[model samples]
Target: MKILKLEKGKLDLFASVVQQFGEVHAPTEHEGKFSFKRLNSWSEARLDYNRTVLPPRKYFLPPRETLFKYREATGYVPATEDLEKRVVLFGVHACDIHALNILDEVFGKGYLDPYYLTRRKNITIIGIDCTPDEHCFCRSMRADFAETGFDLFLKDIGDHYLTFVGTARGDDMVIATGPLFSEVTHSDIVEYKRRSSQKCDTFKLDLEIRDLPEIFELEYQADIWEELGEKCLSCGNCSMVCPTCYCYDVADEVKLGSHDGDRVRLWDSCLFATHALVAGGENFRKTRSSRIKFRFYHKQRGFVAEYGRPSCVGCGRCIEACPVGINIVGVINRLRGVEHASTD
Candidate 1:
């Protein structure tokens, strides 16, 4: 990996050079939290902010999209929205980047999802290393560090930002930034490693990943599901905030008394009562307890069985967004019979 160095004060200038390539989408304040938005100025984006309210996955797989447009007289037509320019998704956290990689595996496997792939192709991900907050547990998931997926990865080391060129896109970006970046020196390498070590020690949350498979399998009928289900409001906030939740439903949305319409796909949450309902009034996951178990098992067990890794990156946005204080780490800890699991 090639390394480059830029002083902290010159960050905006570096972003300006990147802006020449494409529109820059970076973290900015929405209300009380941060989110990715098209920036009018590089300074508007917050490199030091906590995790965004929603993951950056939205850029690749939007909340809603029209699969195809239909007209009674004309039949069916594909409807692919044109995003005019390639995008630079700047300052994405490591966990969000990891989540995006997980999505690539899901969508790019056999029958490639052209809709998501096109958007993914257009984005040049520039990841920024983050110091974990109390709510973050990415370390436990082995998602705190990323080796691929990002075009450029930045880690703060005192007055300078140490950057890693992960791909040709990253090399191009660095070249575009030009004289602003200098070659990394021995001292810079030393400082970068020192800072990275310090950053790893900052996370407070931990999970029992060793026994996760056995715990998940054995907990198929565990009493914890009942307790969690009762507390679950079915608000769907957890799924919405999650970086890796890709569940969705599709349908034709036609105008009243008109045949012209669009076949749209919308984000769907298993937490919804009617999510699993089908024709003949049959519902697979009708009970709240069953739904709760399904959601947890899918992330911890089912995903592992398929992907060789858990769907959860331990970003902990679910824990922060939950109105009832239900967290996956706490659940895993409790299942593993950790002494202070509940209190944690």
Candidate 2:
């Protein structure tokens, strides 16, 4: 990896230069919340934002997408629209980047998904460091800093961004900018380390994930599930906002009069009432308690068995999105028998 620095004043110019690579999308403020959207100009990019409403995962695995178009004559044709569109996702946080890496393991392995892999290849990720909010427990989830899964990563150090180039594409971006980036000095490294230490102290949320899978298994039938299910609305908001949640439902939509139709893949949540429904109206998880428990178990325990890590990145999107204020950190602490688990 190549290390460089970009003056704070040149950030706008750098943003402009990167547009040559692809359509630049960055975090932008809307009212009080933030989201990753196409930036009309560098001024629209909110690099200082804490967290976006949705993670950068949407750029790869969209909320809904057309899988294939079926017709009587041509049979089934793969949907190729926007599959090769080049996109640059800027100001991505470390946890979100880690989430994408986890998704790579899911969609990029076993039954490979061409649509997701194609988008992952075409899109460039530029990660940025963030101040951990009260809800953020990414540090506990081992996602506070990304070791890979990004083109470029920027760390704030006073007047300049300590940039780390992670790939050839990221190096190309640095090269295209001419003298905008400079060699990192000894003082720059010192500042980065000092700020990194300072950032660690600022995190208000902490979780111990070691042996969490075993703990979850032991508490499979704990009363906490029933308590959470009562409060949970079964709205599937958590899964929708989660960066690593990859559950999807596919359906063939036939035209009203013709045989021509399209197969669509839409995001699905295990928390939904119909998620476990099968033929003859037999639902494996009929109760809300079971549905919600399945979600926690799959992410914390089942995923660990398969992927060697929990699917939850601890980005705190689920914490903020839940209307009833169901906090993941609190839930985990309660399961561990911690007295007065931190909810805020």
Candidate 3:
């Protein structure tokens, strides 16, 4: 992998150069939290953030989007090709990046999801190494840092970032920017590996991912779920904040007097009572306990069964976002019979 460094006062220039290729997006402060937003200046991008309120996955799979547009007289017509603009999603955390890869497997497998694919194809991913925060559990999920799927990867080395080239497209971007990076050496690679390894140990949460699915399977009917349901408000915050929760509902919205309207897809949460309800009014998961259990099992068990890996990256945003202080780690820990699972 090639290495590059942005000289002092050249980060904005670096961003500008990348912008010429496509719009540059990165984490920026919004309210009290960080968010992935369009970058107009280098200051707009904050690489030192622990996590964003929402994952960067929204860039590829929007929270809500139109699958297709149609007129009554013309019948169904394919959506316009308005997604040709390329994008540089900068400063994506490794956990979220890994989550995106999982999504790729889901959406790109079998019959391709044209909606997600079109947006994914026009974008380049640039990942930034993050120092784990108190809530981070990426190490537990083994996605603390990425080894693949990123065009460019950056690691902070005091005065400048040590950029790791991961793809030919990434190499071209670094070269085109010109003279920003020092040539990568054998020693630098060794140092980068050493530092990254050291950072992994910083995470307080550690678990054997190999045992996760089995643990979940064994705890499927466990009584801990009922206890969790008691504390859960069923507010749906956990699923909404999750990077891998891709459940959605599609509906057609029509104007008052016209048959012509728009077909839209909006985010849905399994925590909602009607999520699994059928036309005949049979609800598969009727109770809060069942819904909560289904949501967790879907991530830790069902998704692993379907995709060969758990959908959760252990980013821990759900733990932070929950108003009732629901910690998924605690729930998992309690299921595993860990002694110290309880946390207020």
Candidate 4:
């Protein structure tokens, strides 16, 4: 990995220089909360943001994207992003980067999703190390403070920030930018690991993720799901704000007078009553309890079985977004307790 340093008070310069390549996106104030937005000026970017309202996944898999456009007389023409316009996602947190890696497995697997693939091909990610957030549990999930998924990884040192270039694209950017960085000595690497290790305190939540999948298995019949369902409003805020939740529904829309129209895919939540209903009118997960259980299992259990890791990066967006304040960490802890009880 090529290492570089951005001197003190020049943090904004990172974004300014990256902008020269193409569009720059960083955490910026939107209304009242922080969101990843297009940056005209590097100063508009906020690096110390606790968390973004929506994860950076929107840059790859958008909420509402048009796949193709058509006319009644003509067949259809597929739409694609301008691959020439490069986008640099600056200030991405590690958990969000981990979420992107999980999405890569989902979208970039056997059946490549052209829409997500096109975006992935065009954009570059610059991830910032999380100092820690009160609600974040990234440490428990082992979403490293630094990751390989980033083109460049930045760690905030008091005077100068240390940057690691993980890919050829990242190395080229460092070379083109002409940012002066001293060669990283072995001692500096050791110090970086020490400081980053201290950042684990930020994720103070207690979650033994190694035992998560097995705990979930034992708690399938536990009464905690029913208890949570009562408090849950089924508002779908949890799924809506989730970084890795990729479930969607496809539908065709047509003008009132014409039978011709286009097919569209929109975000759908499992919490919805009809999410599992069949044409014959039999719904597999009929009750709110079952749906709630499914969501928890999908993230904590089923996904691990399928993907070899827990789907949650433990960003705790669901805890913050939930109207009833159903904390996922709390749910997992309760399940762990249930498992301990069964073993007794």
> What does candidate 4's lDDT look like per residue over 245-288, in tens digits?
99988777776787667666678889888889988999998888
Quality of model 4 by C-alpha lDDT: 0.80
lDDT of 3: 0.82
TM-score head-to-head 2 vs 4, winner: 2
Error of 2 at 52 (Å): 1.3
Q: Can you list the residue pairs that collide in candidate 2?
A: none
Identify the candidate with maximal lDDT: 2
User: Residue-wise lDDT of candidate 2 within 1-344, one digit each (tens)?
Assistant: 79999999999899899998899999999998999999888888898897888888888989999999999999989999999889999999999999999999999999899999999999999999899888898998999999999999999999999999999999999999989999999999999999999988887888789999999989988999999989999999999999999999999999999989999999999999999899999999999989989999999999999999999998999999998888888998899877544564
**CA-lDDT, candidates in order:** 0.87, 0.92, 0.82, 0.80
Q: Model 2, residue 276: what's the lDDT?
A: 89
lDDT score of residue 137 within candidate 1: 91
Error of 4 at 253 (Å): 1.8
- Who wins the TM-score comparison? 2
Clashing pairs in 1: none
Q: 289-339, model 1: which lDDT tens digit per residue?
A: 888788999999999999999999988899999998987888888888885
Q: Which of candidates 3 and 4 is the stronger one according to lDDT?
A: 3
**Model 3 has how many clashing residue pairs?**
3
